[model samples]
Structure formats: structure tokens, C-alpha cells
Target: MLTVSEKFTAFRIHKDDNNKISSGFEQLSLEQLTAGEVVIKVAYSDINYKDALAATGKGRILRTYPLVGGIDLSGVVIRSEDPRFQSGDKVLVCGAQLSELYDGGYSEFARVKADSVVNLPQGISLRDAMALGTAGYTAALAIQRMEDNGQVPERGPIVVTGATGGVGSFAINMLSNIGYEVIAFTGKTEQAPYLQALGASKLLNRHDIEIGTKPLENAQWGGAIDNVGGETLAWLTRTTHVWGNIASIGLAGGIKLESTVMPFILRGVSLLGINSVEMPLSVRAQGWKRLASDLKPSKLALIAPTTIKFADLPQAFDAYVEGRVTGRTVVEIDASLD
Candidate 1:
């Protein structure tokens, strides 16, 4: 068992009284972390756009100051007050408000709420869990929700917007694995080969396409897994076929939805809002189960090709915030834990 007195390195974010945000590696003991029922010796963590925002102050991500700055982690339980988990069990925590409401995973150790923790599903390593992280988990959740809402291959080809992004990449691979013809809608047409390798059958170049002004344009897609919001999402609403489900996951393009009620009333289209945070434990468990199984991206390596040491984490956020990163980047805290 790890002792509470032992100090470990953590990438911590702090907001000053002047509201200037700064973050760096600092030594901390277990007693200094937020209240939690489970203690984990973290094996791996991963970068998400939210983590970049929190760490760099590019966007406001944390509700409180001076917390560790990773949003996702996978590790082994060294101690647990929760009856559901025991020592030495491998676990993962994603989208449970890490780095937002509670202290996060950018550390050698993590103290997390029991409800936020999940047993690492079979068939994935600790490294694999963080590689998937919240991005992969959210993609899986969007796909699952779409399927539950009657989305099927027969409905039509699934169009994934923000095609070069982490969620978009995973959605493309998972959708294709299950027999759906996947179309990638992206601004980065130069990355056609990368997207195609992830099972995208066609690439819709966002730059060249004309987004028509009609309330309902020609129905082109059976369904959609949208990561870019704003006009791109508006176009999706206008173009998706009857009874097709559009899983709205991100607001990268813009948050304002400028669309008429005609699509919902005339086409019976469903726009399912996909929020990974604050999900029910059962929902989180079921999502992970599927992620370890059918929804697991076959091109996992291609989707998350980079792994950085924990020491390299401070320098990594700038790429993510600048929108220069493609796919996921896993941070290795302790490879031996895998």
C-alpha cells in the first residue's frame, strides 16, 4: 500500500487572486488532494482539449484553483474504501469532472471519487484506457445513443464532422467496423489518407462544400456524429434524412445553433446531446463495456499514435490549444503499471 506521507510529482493548475492562471509540476502528498474514497497509483493519463484549456488558461475549465490538471486517467487501485473495488484492480476514470470539480490525473497518484472510477474493461491495458480516454469514450457514447435512438446502417451513411479530431476519428472507425458506410466531413482534406485509413469511405471537404441556406436541403446523410457545432451542425440538421439521429458532441465551430424547426417537425430527425460528464455509473460502465468490445476502434494505434512521458506534459498542451494536434496523445506516468 502507498503511504499518504509520500510526496509525488503532479502537474497542478492555479488561479491567482488577479485571476491569472498558471500551472506547473509540483510535489504533493495524498492528504493535500481532494476528498475521495479510492486511491490509485496512476499508470497513464491522456490529453483532451479541455485539459489544454485548464492547464494553459486558454479556456476556463476548472471551477476551483490549484488542482491537478488531467481530465482522464487509468491506473491500479492501491487502496479503496469502496466495496466495489479492491487493491491491485486496474481502473479508469473519464468524464467524471476530473480537473473540473475534483483533482485530476496528471500525477503519479490520484485520489478519485468511487463513483467516478471504473474497472478497466477486459481486453484493454492501462495505457489503452488512457489512449481512448474521454475522447474515445464520448465518441462511443454518441454512437451508442444514436443506435438506441434507431440509427442503423440502413438509415444511410453516417457523416462524422470534425473528421480529423479525436472523437471524429474514433467515430469513423467504430461506425465502419459495424457495417455503416462512414463519410468524414473535415476542413483538413490534406489528411485524407489518415482519415481513410481509419475506415472513412469518403471525405467531404468542409472548405469546398456550399452550405445552402434552405431550411431543409437535399437529404444526404443517414445520420451524423457531429463534433463541430455552429454552421456545420446547422447544415447537418438540414441535410440528414428522415428519422436519422444526429449526435451533437462538440461545439468547436460555434455554439449557436442557427436552424429552423422544420427538420424536427418535417423530417423526424433527432438531435441527441452528448455530454460525457456527470453520466450515471451504469451508463459509464455500459459505455466502457462496449468500448472494450464492438465499439473499440480497430485502428486504435493509428488514432492515438503519440505517447509522452509525464515530464513532457507541461509542454504538450500548447499544441492541443492551438488546434495543431490530430488524434490522441497518451501521457505515461508509469508504464510498468500496464
Candidate 2:
């Protein structure tokens, strides 16, 4: 158990009087953390595009200044006012508004709201939990939502945009493991082998495919898990087959939707928005349950190949921000806890 008087290392983000964003490691005590019922000895946290944005000031990710900057964490509980958890329980928190509404996981110890914590599901290790992080979790949520909306392998191939990214990688693997033919839509066609290993049946290079200007083009995909928005998403809406579901996960390309409602009305195409945050606890629990069982990525190691020490965290964000990274990078805060 961590004593209240002990100082722990935390990566904190702050905005100054001049409104410039800055972040770095600092020593912090338990009382300095935001309010929460569970105090965890953080074992692992993973890097996401959001984490990069927060740490580098590339995007506005924090609603409060001087907050710790990790959105996903896996750890062991040391103290809990919540009846659902107790000391030594393995747990995780993802997309719970950490770093935005409260101090987050990029610390040796994290105090998180009881509602935000999850008992780490069986069949996945604490390390594996962080390896999945929000990226895999979001991918699971998207797949679950698609299936719930009546999507099946018989519907035809599911096109996963941003296929080289963490979410896309996990989506491809999980979808394929469950017998869905997965088509990877990516700009980096050179990563064909990598995508193929993740169970993509085919690859569609974004640069080569002429995105038709018609309101609805010939339906090419049964459904899609879209990470890129704007033209790519518009293309998905137009090209998806009848009764198909398009899970809109990210807006890496652009947020504007210029397409008409032709697909939704004419073909019964459903556009499901996949927001990892703000999910009900029941939904969150079920998603993690699936992630541990049926939806578990068979190529988990391949998708998240990098694990770095906590001290190396600052140097890792640039690759994510610059879009030079592939797969996820786990930040090992205390591997001994695992």
C-alpha cells in the first residue's frame, strides 16, 4: 500500500497564464490527486493519439489544467471506498474522462472514481489489458455495435479504414477471427504484409481508388469500421451494401459529412457512431467481457509490439503525433504489479 506521505512520479499536463500547454514528470502526493474512491497502484498505461496530442499540445484534450495525462490504465487496487473493489484486485479504466475531467493514469499511483474502474476480466493479463487500451476497446465496441445491428460475416467483407492504426489493426484481427472477411483500407499499401498478417483478406490503397463523386456508388463493401472521416466516410456510406452498418470511430481525415441521406434511407445503411467515452457501465462491462473472450485479438503481440519504460514516455509521443507509429506502445509504470 502506498502511504499518503510518499511522493510518486506523474506525467502532468498544464496550461500556463499565457495559455501555452506544457507537460512533464513531477513528484506528487496522494492528496494532490483529484477526488476518487479507488486508489490504484498503476501497473501499465498505453499511448494513444489522444495522449500524444495532450502531451505535445497538438490538440485540446484536457478540460482542466494540471491534470495527469493518460486516458487508459491497468493496475491493482490498493484502497477502495467502493464496495465493488478491494485491495489487491486487478482493474482497468478506459475512456473514463481521465486527463479531461480528472487526473489520469500516467502516474505511479492513480486515484480514480469507482464508477470509472473495471475489474480486469479473466483470460487477459494486466499487461494485456493496457496493450488493448482504448484503441482495442473502441474497436471491440465498434464490432459489438455492428453485430448488434445485425452485421454478420455473410453480409460480405467489412472494410476497416485506417487499417494500420491500433484500432484498425485490432478490428481486422478480431473480425477475421470471428469469420468475417476483412478488407483493410489504408494509405500505406506498403504495409500489405503487416495488414495481411492481421487477417485482412485484401488491401485497398486510398490513393489509388478513385473516390466516385456520385451520391451513391456501386456498393462495394458489406459494412465498414471507419477511422477516417470526410471523403473516406462519405465513400463508405455510398459504397456499403444493403442493410449494412458503418461504425464511425474516428475523424482523422476530416469531420465534415458532405454526402446525402441516400444510403441511410434507400439501402437501410446504418451509421453507428462509436464513442468510447460516455458509455454506460453495463455497456462497458459487456465490451470488456467480449474483448477477453470472443473478440480477443489473436495477434495481440503483433498489434502492440512496443513496451517502453516510464522514463521513455516523453520521447514516444512524437511518433504518434507525426503518424509514424504502427500498433500500440505500452508504458510500463510498474511491471512488478502485473
Candidate 3:
């Protein structure tokens, strides 16, 4: 049995007085963790683009030093002051300022606000929740918002950019499962079979999407989930069907949006900005419930996901930074903790 006196290991990022940053596993007691209303014995944590940025110091993701480096974690609550949680309650934490303003789930344990944690919905296991992680949650939120904007499968095909990445992959799978004709835009044409198995009906190579010099183009897709911003997003803005919804989620390509208001003013295009980090608890719960039910992929194991141990995190993070990793990666922090 675990005890409070024992030390736990966590992958932490630290900066020296000279401002040089470094990261690795460190031993720490519970008292050293960020104060929270609840404590969790972490079982699984997943890698997202932001997590990689925080871990590698490649992006301005971490606001504090000596911080745990995971934005998504799943575990059993070991202690709680909140009336809603108790010992042995399965819960998952995604974003909510994790790995930024507070300690996160790169450790065998995590301390977080009770309000930031959500009980695992029925039909989704702890591991399964981590498998979906923040990427899947964000994709589901985008879909939900698009549906609210009158996007329907019967209208036309939905396009997903960066289709091989985490959010794009989940968006394609969920949109396809929901009966939409899903077209995937990817740079990896060789991964066509993988994208097809994920339910993408058509595959467009990166070169296929032109950054035309026009304010507007012919309408194609009825809706789009864009993870790759910049030119790709500008292209979608011009070509999306009238009244089409475009959920702008990531800036993997570039943050600068160079597009005219023609698409919005003329076609009634709706561009939604998805920020998962500060999502409200109620909205998070709804997304998880849908993930546990209608949006759950049948062959989630087929994402060709990679599972790594705690010690392998640094290397995994490097792979992600180099653009070598695709799909989801679950970090098994403690097999026994599960």
C-alpha cells in the first residue's frame, strides 16, 4: 500500500537562475506539490502538442519552473476535501491550467482543484479517457459547436486538416462515425491507409490545398475542423459551403490569419475559436459524456497509438517535437495505481 511519507517521481521542468531550462524525473513528497482540494494517484497521462512544448521548452507553455509536464491525466482520487469526490473515485483531468499555472499529471500522483476534475462517465475506462485526452475532447467540442451552427452530415462533406495528428484524427473518426462524409487533409500521403481506416472518406495531400490569391473560392465542404492554421485555414475560409462552420483549434502551421471577410460577410461562414485550457467544468463534463457514448470510436486501438512508461517521456517528447509522432500516446505512470 502507498503511504504519504514515501516520495513519488514526476517528470518536472526546472529553470536555473541563469534562465536555462531543463527537465527530468524528480523525487518529491506530496507536500511539495501544488496545493489542491483533491489528490489523485495517477494511472495514465497522455501526450498532446502542448505537453510536448512544456516538456521540451520549445514553446512558451510553462509559466513556472519545477512543474509537472502533462495536460491530461486519469486516475483514482485518493483524497478529497470537495463534497463531490472521495477515495477510489475514478476521475480525469484535462487542461484546467494544468502544466501551466499548476502542477500536472506527469507524476505517479497529481494534486488539483476538485472542480477541475471530472468523474469518469459510464462506458469509458480510465485508460480510455487518457486515450482520448484533451485532443479528443477539443475535437468533440468543435463538433458540438458545429452542430449548433446547423452543420449536418446530409449537407455535405466535412474536412479535417492535420488529419494525422491527435485532434484531427479524433475529429475524422467522430465525424465519420456520426455519418458525415469526412475528407482528410494531410501531408503524409503514404499514411492514406491509416487515415482511411480512421473513417476518412477522401484524402487530400498538402499540395492539394492551394493558398489561392482570392478572397473567396468555390464551396466544397459544408464544415471543417482545422488544426493546421495559416494558409490551410485561409483556404477553408474561402471554400467552405455557405453558412458552414469552421472550428479553428490549433496553429501548428502558423498563427497569422491572412484572409478577407468575404467568406464570413458573403457566405455567412462561422469561425469558432476553441480554447480547451480554460473550458468550464460543465462543458467538460458534457464533452466527456459524449466521448463515453456516441463519439467513442469502435476501434480506438487502431489509431496505432504508442504506450510508453514514465522514463520514456523525454524521448517521446523529442519525437513529438520533431514531428515524428502521430496519433495518441498514453504514458503509463503507474501500472499498479490503476
Per-residue accuracy of model 3 over 70-118 as CA lDDT, tens digit each: 9889998888899899888989999688899899999988899988999
Which residue pairs of candidate 2 clash? none
- Give candidate 1 misplaced runs (Cα > 4 Å): 1-5
lDDT of 2 at 266: 96
- 226-264 in candidate 1: lDDT tens per residue? 998999999999999999999999998899999999999
Off by over 4 Å in 2: 1-5
Clash pairs of candidate 1? none
TM-score of each: 0.98, 0.98, 0.97
lDDT against true structure, model 2? 0.94
Native-structure RMSD, model 3: 1.4
